[model samples]
Target: MAMDGKARSAKAALKRQAMKEVELRHTVRYGIKQMLGDLMHWNKISEMGEALQLLILNAVPESALLYRNADIPLMPAEMIRHHARQGIQDRLDDLAGQMFGASHKHVIELLILCAHDAGPEGSAKHLRIPRHEITINENVSRKLDQARIREELRMGRDD
Candidate 1:
């Protein structure tokens, strides 16, 4: 009976470990999707800030940072010193590369520039060529607002 109980305990432990891995995978996937939207300034991205905050905080792992910064004009040394932290950098370079492609660095640079730019409405532009005009659909905006409210309510209940 003890041996059977031990087997059940081990099985339960494995199940918990698997659940944790699944959750991690889901979070990573969701983060990447949101990051892509943030970079592109597309679809519900305006409501999210995690990716931008990570960049602003310079808190992405070093591997992802180096990958994101590849082949781009270096940020001013002062900006780098002020923005980035010195610590153990990880080796997740492939994550940025795979998710962002070759222009990842340039995109990040443009984002930083936009953040610092203090100009009148028409003074600056996003980094994309053949500049497409951005228009928010009112219907979509209403739906997003409703969704946000529902999410807040759900979160309140969970808490």
Candidate 2:
């Protein structure tokens, strides 16, 4: 039996999955990167003050921060001295916990990237291309089981 009352799987996938220190560090850093990316994409966090609050408070659940409007507490003038301190490295390790879940880095990169680059495309001009010549038929791409298993009755084919 599993700790959660669920029966343990005979294969025990968790037992086989172990991350080395290098791989684990990379995974954690990547998760941190993605966490900040997720926030920047939605434009929630802007400054170090916000980043400090989010990281310290553990409000980031599931690798994403739950936005509480205008609730971002400002870092006091005293705390600003160690904005990117090493002490918080431990917090960044589990920034996105296995169960629950940025920083000064990813947000800074995005702020610069968005400022310099165009939208997703090389240029920002909206694509006004018409969709007529796009000849991919929707039906061809639909699910193979689109036709449900109706009652075993032999119905005439609508097609």
TM-score against truth, every candidate: 0.20, 0.20
Q: Rate residue 100 of model 2 by lDDT.
A: 31
**Where is model 2 more than 4 Å wrong at Cα?**
1-47, 63-82, 97-159
**True-structure lDDT of candidate 1:** 0.39
Candidate lDDT scores, in order, read 0.39, 0.34
Candidate 1 lDDT tens digits, 1-159: 256888997896687565442111111211334234445353223422333434433423333334343343332222111111121112123323544543433334434434323233311232222335898899999999999999999999999
The candidate scoring highest on lDDT is 1
RMSD (Å) per prediction: 17.0, 15.7
**Total colliding residue pairs, candidate 2:** 1
Cα lDDT of model 2 by residue, 56-119, tens digit: 4432233233221223223321112123334344555455342232443332322323322333
Query: What TM-score does prediction 1 earn?
Result: 0.20
Give the distance in Å from residue 134's predicted Cα in candidate 2 to where it truly belongs: 67
